[model samples]
Target chain A: MRNRQQGRVIVGFLAAPVILYTVFVASPYVQAFYIALTDWRGLSAEVEVIGLANFAELSGDPVFWKALLNNLVLLVTLPVVTIGVALFLAFMLNAAGGPRSGEIRGVRGAGFYRVVYFFPYILSIAIIGVLWTNIYNPINGLLNGALRAVGLGGIQPSWLGDEKLAFWAVLAVLVWNGVGFYVVLFTAGIKAIPASMLEAAVLDGASRSQIFFRITIPLIWENIRTATVYLGIAALDAFAVVQIMTGGGPNDSTQVGSFYLYQNAFSYGRFGYASAMGVVLFVVTLALSAFTLRATRKERIEF
Target chain B: MTTATHDRVSPQAAAVGPRRSRSARAGSSGPTIVVAQAFLVLWAVVSTVPLLWAVISSFKSDPEIVADPWSLPKALRWENFARAWDAASIGTYFGNTVLVVGGGVALTLLLSAMAAYVFARFDFRLKGALYYFFVAGMTFPVFMALVPLFFVVQNLGLGNSLPGLVLVYTAYSLPFSMFFLVAFFRTLPGEIAEAATLDGCGEVAIFFKIMLPMARPGLISVGIFNFIGQWNQYLIPLVLVSDDSKFVLSQGLANLAVEQGYAGDRSGLFAGLTIAMVPILVVYALLQGRIQAGMTAGALK
Candidate 1:
């Protein structure tokens, strides 16, 4: 009797979340997969099932390929640049230490710098997009203004206008907005490293460069891997920047899979096609995350 | 390991070249560090310049903003904030956002915490399978679900409603919130709960009186994260809500910005943008320490 009652309680406890998850998350996912194999245009009740036809269509879609390639480009570019710069900044801040660290003549304003760097992160992407739209404005914008100031007036370029430059410009905004979080993460990771380890190395007369590459980097490998996976997933999931800034324009040059999916579902009402794209994106993200986990998994060093 | 080699050679180099290259080394090394600092500072300035410009422009006349986009306002136009708030019906949106975020967060915390506790404390069959099932939800990009989700909501007659938005947000945030809480609840001492059980305390009793209080920090952290995510949510609400009265702050701001273009009499829009950013900034500042600690907790472990 007691065992049965205990079992009942456990079942009751698990029921709510499980049901919610099943209904909202799992059910929708299953429905998405089903819709991917159909000809539903999101409005009419009438629909036709076409097994793998949407996938076949996607195979030939040039915009699909472009968006996929843009996502791939973002995946490659963002992680290295954002994480590298963040790690460097974290190391510099860590090396500087506390009050005395900021009191040093050149580093006197480190606290102010940290806040300024992190400020962009708090703003919504809509704001960031709008802000950058003006900054990249061909007429009376900062980029053009600076070019003129530097005597490169003739080289003033339309940043978001040209197809080749649009993607890179968008990528820059992402990196700028994202770097602060990684900086905070890396800084905390660096702080968690024992001071004794560094002291011992210094006592042994180790050069600064030797200590960093051999000791510090190895210790923070987990953070580096985490940051990489995060940025990779972020690149895959990016939408707001592309949506607001270019609306995946310049002839779909800036289109990413998410933005493309949005356009298909909302603008074109091609729900079935968008659902197929969503499935592809899901598979790609899952594969990338698994690959990252596998690559980063090794002997865990207990410090 | 390489420090031994460095030590062995350092004395010889110092003895042989004490004064020969001191000035040159200083000149070269000093400039390098200076250049690096300069670059970092420049990056920081560029990142913040737009926000500063926005805040200042919120106070300026339309002509002034057009004249010098980067310059400070000649006079503060505080009425822009009030005007924008009234014009955009931000009051209604604000109320709806609060309802959705508050209800969603509360439901998420209750459901996820209870579920996490069971997973953490009980050794049930299919536990690993269930845990992995929840984790899989995290792996799926939400954009994929947008179409079907809209259908589901509409089918259930929840379209264009605040409750529908809350329900969707709860579903979306559940995976991570549960994941965090599970990791957290597992860290609690099992013996305490066993003792309560031995004393004939029911599972609900112990959960309410003991585990819930103990899990306060984790719950707070998860709640804060959910609040931020749901508060700033744009995509879900944008799709789920067609009625202006149901819009969240983010969607409202986006609509206003798009309607008025980036440069159009944007003093009011800037004020709206600043107003939208203020609540989040204040909350983040107030809970910055706890939020940062919570974020790093899992990694450090």
Candidate 2:
């Protein structure tokens, strides 16, 4: 009788979610695989199973390759710069407050600083895109304006207007927008390290750098690793910011992969070709995630 | 490493600890600490300056902004905002966004909580498979499934409709909600529900009365996270809602910026950007700690 009641509850509770999920969420994921293999323009009644033809077209497509190459560059530089800067800032914030006391007090106004630093991360990326575009404006941008003000007028170039500088300009914004989250993340990780561990290292006459590399980083490896993966995933998709800021322009200097996928599917209605890019992206994302998880797997350090 | 040595080391730690360091610290930390603090101050400014710049720039005339970008606005051009709201129809866009995001967040919280409750407490056939199915959604980026989702929405007769967008948002939000909430429910003691069960309370009553209130924090965290994600949602509304009038705030702002961006109306453009960002900033500021705690709560766990 008890087992029967359990069964009834399970059936009643699970039915709606299962049906809603299967139909709406799970179905698309499944159908994408089929769609990628078909010549469906998203509005078509007939979808021919074109097999590997879309993949063939992707290999020859220069715009697709350029976009993928840009993604690769972001995947490398964004994580390194963001994580490196975050770790250093987190350490400074962790160490900045009070006297040389061994306690883990933060800088003067740490909580206030935390709240302020994390300010940009909470706002929409679209707003950020718009805001940065103004800051990078050729005629009236704050950056070039400041340069001219400082009597370094000759050094100022159109920051986002130049093909040489556009990619780096966009990258700077990505890093600026992302670093606050990591500062918060790494601060938490550093705080979790037992105060005793730091005391032990300090007592053992470890230099600041030694204490950081030998003790602090080894302990915070898990957070760093997780952050790397999350940042990696974020780097893979630069859709809205790029679309809003540069529109992959100045001769396609900043076109990332996911936006290209959107352009092909929607702007051009080449759904099949776009789906093929989507499949490749899925595989790349999955592989990168899996690799990071595997590579970062270390013996758990007990505090 | 032995217990005896560990006990003996405590005195050394105390003797050579912060007390000894304080004498040596003042002489040593002069330059390095100063440099570190300066870097932090610089970073703080880097993060903050643009938003403030945008807000203040919204009030300046186009010519003034171009003439001396650093100077304070000559006068507060309130009409920049009025023009943005009126001419660009940001008011209509704001209403549409509130309706869609508000509805989507509510439905996602409800459906996901129910499903997560079952997954945590009950055992049934295909239970493992089903739970994993929901968990898998968190890893899959929405862009991967966009084309099919677009097709699916149209086929379901949800084309260009807020309800349709809400349905998609709720469905996509499930994985994160299920992942976060199932763990929450598992952490909850089962004895409360069992005791309630002994009192002959119905299952529905047990969930709504006993468990729901208990899981309030989990619900809030997951709910707000869903709210933020839905509010900033751009890609889904872009493809699914073809009617410009039905666009969410993200799409609306992007459209507004693009339209006014070319006409060189700097004040109006900045004003539109400010309008789009202000509400999010306000909500985030008021609930900053809660949102941070909720968002990073998953990571910390």
Candidate 3:
């Protein structure tokens, strides 16, 4: 029989974490709602409550809108570009290795290839931001230097400085940093499919692309779905990237919601307004995650 | 067996024959395999080259780097690293990062594992709601809550301190740490606990002496994950801890880049970047497989 001591143990085990989690993580979340209504300059004292003014002002603020639009762009582009390329590379690494049960196994150096693909995932995003900053340097960077060497200097542009191209430049670095992770991820997922299934599809006269779309894609839907949600969440909060890379960029073309929220609270001392934006960011993240889970939800095909 | 004989002959064919007969390698199309190989190679190069440049550029003089960003260093300007480590105070930042990340990871794992054990094994009335409460922590952006969190941390009178950063790190890390760990605890068979309990071992003993030991792999993986995440944390420390001497590595690196403009020594900048990156890179290189397994275990689930 479950006794009083056991109940005491359960409470003790759960108490600290639950309380700490609530105090540190959950309380801030709930507190943000209340604090959003107040005009606090990051201090506890001398704060007056302002009802919906921050939200009202936020609705018309163009910088907040620009940041939201940039996040929208990342949400749309980063996932599609990253997932598409990851699927291809994963298939190329895993499926194109011919038959597992046949004479040969996976692709040659498959392990090595995976390590290479996964290398970028370990680096800090801030580090990635710094590395790309140097690479995108107009005068002495690798990109423009290589472009000039190819004798097509006319097309070379100041990557981070060009207003027309700054957003795309940031997105390019994000894609480059992100694609390798998904490639390794989908590779693991694709590798789990029984080889006989794929070999049968091949013997049945199915082409590579056909087998990919019909068989492999459906099988790895779970991974794709999870990856999509994570990527979408990441896209919604492009704080470290934008903060390090361009600091919201030339003319605010690449300011994301999280970074904007940060700048308002820390830089401009506008806690109330920032909390309003924070609320919106939270809602968008919630909606984005919900949308991904729903959009990618399908009948799970057990192997 | 024809298959066996074909296997024997295939390697020789793959090695000796040109690209025209390279299908013997994997039975895929010749040019397709070649193209795919080329594409993957290209991608790998793209991924590695930036880091490589960062490392190599660390050793070069600024003029040499500017002259040929692609070329190898002519002078082994070890001064750059020295200047960055001492002059730019990267060494101090690195030590600070070590302390905070270490504290954060240890506390996060302890709190998460304890909470996860309850969520995994217990069936209390609010268990479902409480677990979902932590799970929902995964979705909300941490910075979105920063405005209020600032007030909370400031009001607690723990501003600009390493311990405060550690507490914040542990708190924010709870959600994912708990989520990842609850799955691990669930996978562990319950019969052992039942047996231990039946033998008169108490609940705490059963968990500590029985279940916690079994959850080591999960703990290690989660530890490494939380360590990396806490180390890379920029926004939290950037906003909360403003003291220059107490800055974490990422925050310090940002200071070097954004605040001081790398003190006008480009090579020192690369040196600081290299110093910041190398330790993690080494650990990652050693435990690449394990890290990936632990980090992506959820995707598979």
Candidate 4:
């Protein structure tokens, strides 16, 4: 009797979530692959299986190529810069304090700094996009206003309007928005390192930079690798930021794969063409994730 | 919230320095520490000034914002917020978001909890496969599903409606919520559940009366995480809902920015952005420790 009751409970518990997941998420993902082979306009019930024609078109599409290239650039730069700065800041906040009576300490107000730095990470991407778009405004913007106040106004450029600078400007916001979470993440990783190990290094007359390089970094390698993968995935989907801020404007300099896919399906109503791009992006994301995992694989230093 | 912060902080404090180890004490000059302090202070300012500037500019007149970006508003003009609320319909957008995200987060927690409890405690065939099925969704790019998902929603006649938005949000959120909560439920001691089972409790009754309450901390963490995620969501709402009156906060704010930025209602745009930021700001201020833990907890595990 209890066995039968447990079975009923399990089925009842799993039924709604399972059905909802299948219809809304699982099925749609499966269908994207099939839809990619079709010439579906998304306005009609009719869809024709064109057998890789959309992929054929995608190969020659300059905008899609440009967008993919930008994603690649982000894949490299966003992780490197954001991780570099976050590593430095995390070290400073958690371990860079001057030794007090041979004890390594985080700088004063480390907790306070952590909270303030994490502000951007909590806000919606839309708000971040809007906030930075206004801040990057060519005229009457905070950045330029600060520059002019310091008497460097002559070098002011139209940040979003200039195709050369637009992509980099957006990338800067991405880094800014991401660095705080990693600082906290890396701080936790650093905190996990045994204090005795660090104290031994200090007693042996190791410099701050020396201890950081030789000891702190090796132990936190897992955190850094995890960060690289997450940031790489984030770099792939620079959709919301690009869509809200530039709308793939300034000569399409900042077009990203996800945003381009969005435009193709929503703006142009070419569902088939967009699905092709989606499949390519999905493959690249999987490959990058696997590559990051394998490339960053190292000996686990058990503590 | 208090417990989560204390749990994370105390261990680090004990690890960083123990006065009992007097022999290990070392000292360095003050200049290095000062420099590090200055650097961190600079970054904190960099992180906050744009937000502060936006809040400050929201009160300025349109000409004042254009003319003097840095100066204090000559007078507190609350009218900008009013105009955004009434004319631009930020008020309506705000309500729609409250309804959708509230419903979405509640549903996500309940459904994920029920499923997660079973996954955690049950012994059954195909359990691993079913759990992995949910976990696999974590890595699949939501972009790939957009084309079919749009049509799927339209076919269900949930197109352009707030309830449809809630369901989609809940669907996408299930993977992470289940992953987190299943691990969470496992961490819970099984003795109390066993005792309840022996006390003539039905499995469903044990879940509602005992297991769910025991899982409160985990539920709260996952709940806040989903709340913030669904509240800030952009793409899902943008694709799923097209009706203007049904727009969520993110979509509404983006539209307001484009429309008002071009319409030269600069102060109004600033006001709208600030208005949109309020709930998040308040939540963060109150439960920042929980928020940080909720977000990073998944990545750590």
- Model number with the top TM-score: 4
Candidate 2 lDDT over A1-303, as tens digits, reads 767777787788777777777877788888878888888775745779999999888889898888989998999999999999999988888854433444545666677777878877887787788788889887788888888889987887787778999999999989988898888889889998888888766656566677678887899999999889888998999788899899897789999888898998899887877778888999999999999899889998988
In candidate 4, how many Å is residue B46 off?
A: 0.9
Give the Cα error of residue B139 in candidate 1, in Å.
1.2
Question: Can you write out model 4's per-residue Cα lDDT over B33-121, one digit (the tens) per residue?
Answer: 55666779889998899889989999999999999688899999999999989898999999999999999999999999999999999
Tell me how candidate 3 scores on lDDT: 0.83
- Local accuracy by lDDT, each model: 0.78, 0.83, 0.83, 0.90
On a 0 to 100 scale, what is the lDDT of residue A64 in model 1? 98
User: What local lDDT does model 4 show for residue A233?
Assistant: 93
lDDT of 4 by residue, A109-154 (tens): 8998999999888889999999999898878988888889999989
Which runs of model 3 end up more than 4 angstroms from their true locations? A98-105, A153-155, B1-28, B198-200, B259-262
Candidate 2, residue B48: how far the Cα is off, in Å:
0.8
Tens digit of lDDT per residue, candidate 3, span B23-87? 23334444455566667777888878888889999999988978877789987899999999999
Off by over 4 Å in 4: B1-29
lDDT of 1 by residue, B131-205 (tens): 899988987878878889888889889999988887888888888888899899999998998999899998899
By TM-score, is 1 or 2 better?
Answer: 2
Quote the B-chain TM-score, candidate 1: 0.86
TM-score of chain B of 2: 0.90
